[model samples]
Target: MALDKQDLLFAGLMGSKAVNLIQNANIVNNELINRVLPVIPFLPVKNEKNNVTSKSGHAINAEDNWTTRDSIEDQKQFFPLSFSFKENGQKWLFPYEPMINIASGNSIVKRNVAKQGDKLIGTIKERWSRKDFDITVTGVLIGSIMQGKPEDCFPREHFSKLFEFLKHSKEIFIYCHPLDLISVNKVVVEDYSFPFTKGENVQAYELKLTSDYSYELLIKDDF
Candidate 1:
């Protein structure tokens, strides 16, 4: 007996779902999430096979060997901040003076000095660096409030601040655990691509926040 077209379509859908479930399960079991956590920096390293070993078991290719000097040179700097309700007690103080300028083609730099009264904050210096791709972000955990109240959440205010800061930023970074799944439902930023990198046993995401801020987030494993 021949199966109906609807039945075949339903079977195909079920098969697709099954394949997706298996793929997802494999991803989870392999702990791919830990590799993409935004807070952690991923540095590329030279493979050991490339090393030339002498009779003394010492690597002869010193210049080609992986060293801190080269690693530091290739290092991509990133900064991220987390806010919580417990830290600030109640009030939120957001006194930020951003030095990043996209039009000027300069890297963001910030300096702080103690004063008698309120803190003095402003851009002290701005200059373009050869390492323009290197980015630094500082997140101030501007206290959090109860989630029960709509006003307390300050969703719009928080989004506004993020928008203003990311207006010139190339990317935004986020950190999460393997179990910490995220949804794009309420995210305000637009025009961005997320590239996820996996480690030997974990997963992470490198978010290119263009038209936004670019950053990385590594998903941690449950201990």
Candidate 2:
């Protein structure tokens, strides 16, 4: 069916999969962890291979018939998202976009090549390395409530979950989306930077992770 402008726009918006979620993270100490961040307003990167050079000369060296061959080579995927929070009478200013890293297996070619007719037949299958990813969540903390009193500006309890995670190691499930999940990943805090003033606010946060679950586990959730 031919699509109109409105249809195309809707597909672009919905099919883009702008929405993403992190189901739940491990608890460090007694502080609760943060989940759910906004996907940065940008296009998701996809590394794709449309064709491959023929290594086997089955067709008299006539280009080896590279028709219907493609693949995606990125084993790891990264995303930039926005996060903000208001707590302890202080509102943290989201200075810059935060990046979330996702690890995935590569797509592979599963075609049967006929040496006589130079024909290729089969399907492209995406191989998932694991369902779980050991992901470290980190972001920048630029500005906070400036007009508040000293006591209010600095809460009695600092947002120390990051520190707790650093000291206490734990594995938790992270929902990449509602149906998709990265489960039982060892999560930790790393590469934290002190706040610095820039045009907006700039600071850095980092997390370290590893996983054994498949990246596409959600597809088979029913089983």
Candidate 3:
């Protein structure tokens, strides 16, 4: 069947409009992808609480009452970050965004059994009643190191030794509270001190570890 000129022109216009619609959709999709990709690191929620130890060797749950800005948007704007290392090719990359646990106020005690001078004995007695605290770190994993070569991600040297240790391990151990699993975020390492952030949306996230450290070793050995 033969179509009139007007009908043919209308069909051509519709086709052009459809093509423009598709191009616009593609552009929108690409923009969304780019916006979301960089947000992955900040997405995982990390929750941590405090534990207090008594001089009698008993431990108690201490409140995690550290305060921070309420909104996630505020956190994104003000989150303080430190650097760590990852291996690439023949050298190490500095300042990789590796997962780490920051534990504060952990302590150990020793009893004095020997009798001493009056002042010394008094000091020991006072010490026995006092509690000590220190900060310790554990469960460091380099995300960029474990993942494929970063397109242009810079690495940091602070994590060099930790990266090496993870490289040689067969299995990494994670300790976490059972209750944390059911919460919004999974706790990666157990018994780590986490500062408190305020707001209704505040939550916790679990850190990732691997049973096979070989992958880490391969990446580190690349350098």
Highest lDDT scorer: 2
* Regions more than 4 Å wrong, model 2: 1-98, 106-136, 147-158, 172-179, 182-203, 212-223
Please report the TM-score between candidate 1 and the true structure: 0.19
TM-score of each: 0.19, 0.30, 0.19
lDDT of 3 by residue, 1-223 (tens): 3444533432332233324444443445454333311222221233443221112111311232222211122123222122123322132221222223333242335557577666665323323332221213321222222112232111233333335533542333322222224221111222332222122222122233321122243444454
Per-residue lDDT of model 2, residues 1-223, tens digit only = 4555533432343233212221122222112112222121122232244322333322233242222111111222122221112112222222232345666554454554456353534543444333344354545432222122333222222234334434544433332331145333223333444333221212245556554333464564565
Instruction: Output the worst ten-in-a-row residue range by lDDT, candidate 2.
Output: 68-77
* Cα-based lDDT for every prediction: 0.28, 0.32, 0.28
Q: Which stretches in model 1 have alpha-carbon errors above 4 Å?
A: 1-22, 25-146, 154-157, 169-223
Global lDDT of model 1: 0.28
Candidate 1 lDDT tens digits, 1-223: 3445433432332333324344334444333223211111123444555332222113233443222111111022221122223323332222221111121144556554456255545545554443222222222111122122333322345444444534533323322121023221111223322122222211111212222223568877899
RMSD of each: 25.7, 24.7, 27.3
- Candidates 2 and 3, the one with greater TM-score: 2
Backbone clash count, each prediction separately = 27, 10, 18
